[model samples]
Target: MPAPFRIYNTLSRTIEDFAPVKDGHVGIYVCGMTVYDHIHVGHARAMVVFDAFVRYLRHREWDVTFVRNFTDVDDKIIKRANEVGKDPVALAGEFIGHFHDDVGALGLANPDHEPKVSETIDGIQAMIGNLVNSGHAYEQDGTVWYSVESFPEYGKLSGQKVEELRSPDEVPGKRAPADFALWKAVKPGEPAWDSPWGPGRPGWHIECSAMSLGDIGETLDIHGGGLDLVFPHHENEIAQSEAANGKKYVNYWMHNGLLTMTSGQKMGKSLGNVINVRDALSQFPAESLRLYYLQSHYRSPLPWGPEALPEALAMLGRLYEARENAEAMGGSEPVEQVISGLGEDAKKVFELGQGFTSRMYGALDSDFSTAQALGYLFELARAVNRLANHKKAKKRGGPVVAPALAAFASVAETLGLMAMSSADFMAEVKEKRLAAMGVSHDAVEQLLTDRRQARADKDWGRADEIRNQLDEMNIVVMDRADGSDWKVRLVAAN
Candidate 1:
């Protein structure tokens, strides 16, 4: 049986039971990008959060059908295309391809279905026609407008009183301030499709209504997007979808919180504060981005700062070090015997490791509290490290840490964290951090060579000087039995 989980519903404004329409199955639809430009770090958060959610669900044995759509033929696309002197469709396609590349670099899974607006035009028109025939929409000149008054429950999703809204733009034939456009009459230069109402294209909200229904059904198990979309975008979706289908549009509305700058303002391209995903990934491993996003609760506002990624990288290094420490232990003795011989530290690690899977599941199952789940992981990692400090731990401690290793594997399978081998992770850290800090590996290598020669010749003062210089550059030189290996340290968070 698939494990049960709880999720906070934006529509109900409370945590609710996530009952699927079908047994052991969930159909989820998330609003995707407009495909007009590169995806920023803010956009990457939504992508990573939802990707982790689906991966977790599947890890619990639930069959999930996830659909995220691309708004390829939007006004923004047309406007950007005109600015760049390229065809709108070609421009959208270019961005869509770039989106895939960025998503891949960020280590995200491909959504089960990525429906596009231009490709689904026929279905969009059909949904519009259904609204018109059902008296839920009306034709105004060549454009179709959804009648907000026709649906008494229009404001239930967003909780905004219709009368409080601004007066509708006088587009020559629009009836009311609250009634949104269903199908826009195409402007001369914009992309056009033949419809019963005339030559026009889908309105912003209606495209999701049609594409979601086409991919899933009349009602989705969960619908998700950024918290910013809860206003006009999601509100309009609920009205048009439920009004036209005569059924509940969605069982749960899940909106991830937006990223906020340290100044308490939301991150946006208009503000010139956006960090594109490519730029971020070029400086750090993909897991650094994932850790940075997952460290906070999904519904909480994530604060982006100069030390955000660096702090996350530091935290990640801690986990990797502990895992490596545990993996390095050598023993074949039974765990009970090893624990009996090693005392409290061993006992703590064994207990935490044994309970880790259940505790982790408990945290994640309760409203997908990734922050809480990661709390358990970090605690286990600390326990492992503390146990490794025992003198006998190197050779005789493997049995005691076996369960902890299993716990790490479980985390990788379920949460997609710590999936890489320790050596690979450590190597990636050196490569990205060196480049990010503009430190040349060759220069660091030469310094290490000079330090080794000074040590070989018993020149303590010269060796100490070289090590001190490396420390100034945020590098830590570790002396292992094999040799000296150095690592670039992440910045400490304030």
Candidate 2:
């Protein structure tokens, strides 16, 4: 059996115990990108949240089939193609390739099935045909409109009522203002497919309804998207799928909160505040971006600003530092003996490390509380750091911190964070962050060499001067017993 866990269901507006459609298995469908442009950080929040959720389930030995779709045919794609003088299909295809590149750089695993709206036209038409046959939809002037009134339970998902709702698309020949399109009549220049009504394409809402039903069955184990999609998009999905299949649309509705700006508005492309994932990956290590998303609860609004990635990198550095310190200890003495000799710090590290797994699981199993799970990891890290401060820890504390090392390994396997070796992580940080800051590596190295020579010549003033110069360049030099080293500073110099 799969490990038991609870998830917040947007449909029920409460956290409920998760039970899959099949024993030891889950079938999830998440709404994917529209494919008109590069995916932004706001879009990546949904991607990373679902990716981590699936990772945790698989780590607990559950069989998961995850499906995310592409909306390759849309009004936005057509508009963008027209502006760029390219075919709409070709433009969407270009962005799909870019999407793969960006998400791959972010270390996201591909979904089990990536259904596309353009390829799933037959499925979309079939479902619309069913709704029309069952009196849930009607056709006029080669356009099919879903009669929202036919489904009395239309408002259940979004708490919206038909009388109180106005259709965002003001197309001609709609029976009611609240009724939305199932199939749009093709214009002279738009893409079209042959359907029962005419040569028209699927509407934005119906493509998801059909693709999800065809891939996952009549009812999905979980249906997920961003919180901004809860209105007409998700609500229409529920109406169309349930009305056609005569079954529950989804067992649980999972929605991740949007990334919000400091001005208290949601980040969006139209708002011109969007940061593309590729642009972010160019400056920060992929794991740093992952850490930024995982630091907040998936259901909570995450704040975005200039300091977000920098702060996340700093936090990641601390965790790696603690793990490095724990790994450096070299004794084979029993942990109890080391604890007795080194006192409270050693004992606390031992206790926290041994108990870390259960504490982490307890947080993750209840509502997938990543924030709480991360809190426990930070607490363990602090304990290990404190124990390392003891003078005897390096020579005689290996056994004492062994469990702590195991705890760190567990976090990597479960969360896809800290998977890189400490040395590799530091190297990546230097390469990317230095390039981002426009600092040349050879210049920093030459400065370090000059500083080393100045120290050798007993020129304290010159060495201090060079140190201050490097500091201005956002570099921090470390003077150690073995040798001197430097790193790109995680925080901006004031």
Question: Clashes in model 2: which pairs?
Answer: none
CA error at residue 127 for candidate 1, angstroms: 0.3
Ten consecutive residues with minimal summed lDDT in candidate 2?
Answer: 163-172
- In model 1, which runs have C-alpha deviations exceeding 4 angstroms? 492-494
Clashes of each: 1, 0
lDDT of 1 by residue, 249-285 (tens): 9999999999999999999988999999999988888
Total residue pair clashes for candidate 1 = 1
Q: Residue 174: error of model 2 in Å?
A: 0.6
Clash count, candidate 2: 0
Each model's lDDT comes to 0.91, 0.92
RMSD of each: 1.3, 1.2
Instruction: Write one digit per residue (lDDT tens) for candidate 2, span 64-173.
Output: 98999999999999999999999998999999999999889888889999999889999999999999999999999999999989999988988987777655776679
